[model samples]
Target: MVKSELEKLGLHFTNIDLGVIEIKETISKEQKQKLKSNLAVSGLELLDDHKSILVDKIKNVIIEMVHYSDELPKVNYSDYISEKLGYDYTYLSNLFSEVKGITIQHFIINHKIERAKELILYDELNLTEISYRLHYSSVAHLSNQFKKVTGQSPTFYKKIGKKRKSNLENL
Candidate 1:
């Protein structure tokens, strides 16, 4: 979708991926504005500012790791995010909190809890399995986080159907 939009504007790019686009040439202000407008039509926003771009990158990496990866990495998340973005964990955490108004750890926990809700809704995984899949240390920990975040238990969520689940984008 994004690639086609860029092509429509006659822009050249060396690479494009989730949360990142590398144009082959510098685009003028008008061209950037046009591209932003075009992308907005598809519910996408261009992040040209350095801090916003980095924050978006942080969100993307966390989202992918939490919601998409088959297995969560075993390393500490701060270490993982820092290594992934090549910035000090403190720097990234401060910038993320300053811009998004939430700590990185809080963001990851929200995503983890949401993913757990999704798995619970599927009815294919028990709480223990869901905890394991989400890399929680134990079922109790997962249940605690789930209850803290959603005001309900995982079992309650399973019995309640789909209303309690959150759309990933909204988080």
Candidate 2:
């Protein structure tokens, strides 16, 4: 979608990834506006500010790590984000909190909880396996966080999934 939008505006980008775009040349205000408007039509926004771009990069990294990666990294998340973004963890934490109104740890926990929900709904892994896959210390730890974020136990979520599935089949 983004590439097509860029092409529609005759813009040349050297690279495009999850949250990064490298244009071959500096775009004029008109082109930028057109690109922004075009992307907005597709439910995307152009991040022009440095802080917003950095925050978006942070989000993309976390999302990729949690939802897409085959396995969670075996290092501290702060250290991982710091090393990946080439900034101090404190600075990243402060910036993320200021911009997102949530700490980085909170963001990670929310995403982890979301991923846990997905695993539960899939019914492919037991809670223990899901805990290990998500790098929680134990099933209890995963369950606690899951309940904290989602207001329900993993078992409850799984049961709701089953009920929903049965309802859909009956319909």
Candidate 3:
């Protein structure tokens, strides 16, 4: 759908994946605005701002690390992020903190915890496997972090799952 739309505007896109479109030729302002408007009609905004780009890169890196990668990197996260972004870890950290109002570490932990919840809900891997997959030092460490964020143990949360639907009349 997106590829056809781009072609309709006489743009040659080498790649059109999800939110990305790779065009080889430079486009005029009118063409750019037309493309932007077309995309906006379908609820996609073109973000060309440098700060937004950097912030998005930071988020994508963390998301890929936590959710998609088969194995967590052996190196510390700071080194991993620096290598991935080709920028000093400190600079990335400062920029992320300023824009997102949280440290990168916190962001990573939040993703990890969400993954942990999904794994627990899936009822496939044991806590030990999950801890190792996510690179927590131990099950105890994972439990502590999960409890800290959720106010409940992972086991307790999983067991609770969802209560039978409540009735408003019962109130």
What lDDT does model 3 reach? 0.87
CA-RMSD of model 1? 5.2
Per-residue CA lDDT of model 3 for 95-120, tens digit only, reads: 99998999999999999999999888
Cα lDDT, model 3, residue 116: 96
TM-score winner between 1 and 3, please give it: 1
Which pairs of residues clash in candidate 3, taking residues 3 or more apart in a chain or in different chains?
A: none
Error of 1 at 134 (Å): 1.4
Better of 2 and 3 by TM-score: 2
Which lDDT value does model 3 have at 75?
96
Query: In model 2, which regions exceed 4 Å deviation?
Result: 1-10
Query: What lDDT would each prediction earn against the true structure?
Result: 0.91, 0.91, 0.87
Query: Which digits, one per residue and each the tens of the lDDT, describe model 1 over residues 1-171?
Result: 889988988999999987789999889898899999989998999999999999999999999999999799899899999999999999999999999999999999999998998888888888888899899999999999999999998888787765444544356
TM-score of each: 0.85, 0.90, 0.81
